[model samples]
Target: MKKTKVKVKRLKKGSNIAVISPSNGLASVFPHIYEMGLKNLSEVFGFNMVEYPTSRMLSKDLYTNPKLRAEDIQRAFQDESIDGIICTIGGYESVRILEYLDMDIIMNHPKFIMGFSDATTFLSYFNKWGLVTFYGPSVMAGLAQMKNMDQSYEKHLKDMLLKNNKSYVYKPYKQYTNGYKDWSDPELVGQCEAFYDNENGFEFYLDDEPSEGELWGGCIEVLEFIKGTKYWPEPDFWYNKVLFFETSEEKPSPMAVGYMLRNYGIQGILNSIKGLLIARPKDYTEEEKEDLKKIVMDIMTLEFNVKDIPVVFNMDFGHTDPKLILPLGCVVRIKPKENCIELVESPYTNKNK
Candidate 1:
């Protein structure tokens, strides 16, 4: 796919932000945290909250129906009152909804769409439409962090959603909240342990010297499952692109990561990209994190032969707290020698009246 520049629009205060669930309907089951997320958006972020038909609907059978899930997303984008769209939470089966979405509607609006985990499916779709979408923090997860949202996480979100800065330096937080609180007890709402971080910053490697390219890719597992599907781009689409991906709580085995990378190599996907951003590994234990990192790096070097490819590890933009919102279709600069990564465009584009 040829690179096309789409200017992102800066949203003003008081604009209505639409919150919808395109994946699992967790909002219906966990109304406490869901409502808490709404409160933060209205009272803290100062945006009017809007909900869709299935925004808070709960059904054991709905999980198996991908059509209904896709309808909710279509309705949200068609509503002109909505200035932006956010997912309520992430879950499996989001990939199933890909066939039901109206790409024309989403591309026409070109509004800000944000989510991670399963949300990566929609993000990739939006990218194919030539629109930039966000991959980071969900409504109930990051925005509704108990006690309060992480200061750094909130800051990065505000910067991307409201401002137009071309460069943002990611900072790892010393502590993070996983949103593990007693839902039955209202008093336990805002309680969580602060995750400690001792790392200084991301480590980058430049393969063909400094290079810039359009950002692509998402959660590694999600991409693999949809690899052969129509939703995934062709081999040439990934050529010379900047690939960014992170793992989820399932804690995929190191062998699994290598297999996926090897598949990309076989498909000629690995050699086509300008850079790669592999986020910090999430596992059951700290030792597992270390083991996964070593395995991933070795695969990149040996199997993929992307030795000079600038790869940055431990960036806070995945399942971890205090995550940074990454623009999927935006131009990203990767300087491996300097150990720096910067976003060069806004994700939102103005709709001409």
Candidate 2:
């Protein structure tokens, strides 16, 4: 997979942002949140939200229709009016759509596509084709909130979508939610997740003087699961990149985390990257945090034999509420001395729509 210098266009006010379900049809299971998300996308974000054939057509086993999902995505991209694409929600098997996608159509017509969780399947796919994708929020869980969207989360999202053509720097705030309320509960229509304070900032490792590169990687479990699949980038593709990965609500044990890193170590990926931006795992207990950190440090030292890799862990994103919108393949700087992470290049271009 030879790579090219691929840049994508950004979103603008009133631009059509197509919403599609790339994985599980969570909307059928939770219609209220889906509707709320549509309303929010229109009234709050001020975008002409459009849905394709399978955006909200939910089912238990019906999500296996990868062709439908893939076609919806292709159609969304082919639609000239659409300026951005947001996945409806993440599911268990977004990888199924890989074989069905029209890669030429997608690569030729790039837009600001953003997702996470199972959508890592597609995020990594587009990125491999040299198009920058986003690893961030989805429709139901992020755009549609119970009471209201988090102020910080919406601001960053808008910053990226509305073409803030400058180096973007995200600040550390002592507020975030680890999980969420049940979206299926009809009684909790106006409720959101509770916030927790005392959440630590991004912790540095091995004296992170400064490291910079384009963002790579996605949900750790998904990355590990998709390993050896065609979607996983080659070893050369991992070189000189800032690997961004986070765990999900599944809460794989520290042992599992160790094994995953060991696999990366064996693949020479651990040594290939300039730095790691590890997101705070979902539902991680305080004790488990220290335990996981020890596991990572040990693996990097004893097994991988690559110590002193610059790392900034415990940052907000992944399944966590009020997450940051991170653009894959955008040049970013991790400055440990200033305790700051900033984007150096504008991720957006003033191209066609």
Candidate 3:
């Protein structure tokens, strides 16, 4: 299949960004975070946040209803005033609304759409329609970051959303943090830092020295949730793709991760990819992390048997703090020897021109 060039438009100051609840209705339950996120957009990012019908609706029960969530997404995409869309929070039911989305409407207005975790389903849809979407910080996750947005995270996000750049380098942060605190607690809000070390960086075991291709994939659990549905692309569609995957907060067992990878191997999906990027597994215990990594390596080596494939472990992108913003369906180049990952194509067109 011929690849399409993605045009990333620049986001100017004071642009309107729509905050929609496409997954879980966290906005309804934790209105404070939603408000803080919006405030950050206006005060910090210099962008106004537009809240739709479901933005503030906090009923966990209502979130399970896919049609309602789909309506929120459709309305946001159809609105001409909104410059881009950002998800509120990620939840399991996001895949349920896959069929309800009007891809035609989304395709016509290809603006900045950002999310991760369950949002992978939407990203896959956009990829199928030849559109570029972001697999990074969400409103609640990044904008409403516990204290303030991580400097490393904020930088990459701005680069992707505001500055149309072909490629950017990612460096590990000195610290990492997560969870929420009272807004009134100034110390708590401002002092939260992530767990980071100087040793953090990209390490690739590659059969091929250097490789480049369009980047794809997201929360592995979310991808599996939408598998066999209309949202999933044909198996062969992932051929020669640079697949980037990360685990979620739930931290499923190592066996679970291995099973999923084994399935992909069985389907011949592993052999067709140009490379693979796995984020640091967010398991609770140190032992679990080791086990999960072991499981992943074993599956990739034994099941896939594509030992030469470039694979990077412990790269930040998943349910971790100080995350890097990834452009879904955008071309990225990976050099294993140099341990460098570079974006080689623009995901949007010129917005400033």
Scored by TM-score, the top model is 2
Q: lDDT per model, in order?
A: 0.73, 0.79, 0.75
List residue ranges in candidate 1 displaced over 4 A: 1-8, 59-61, 146-150, 177-179, 182-184, 205-209, 350-353
Angstrom error of the Cα, residue 295, model 2: value is 0.7
- State the weakest 10-residue window (summed lDDT) of model 1: 1-10
Give the CA lDDT, 0 to 100, for residue 11 in model 2.
68
Of the two candidates 1 and 3, the one with more favorable lDDT, higher being better, is 3
Cα deviation in Å at residue 313, candidate 2? 1.3
TM-score per candidate, in order? 0.91, 0.95, 0.91
Please give the distance, in angstroms, between residue 142's alpha carbon in candidate 3 and its true position after superposition. Answer: 1.8
Give the best candidate by lDDT: 2
Question: What is the lDDT ranking, best to worst?
Answer: 2, 3, 1
Model 1 lDDT tens row, 212-234: 77888778988876788787786
Which TM-score value belongs to model 1?
A: 0.91
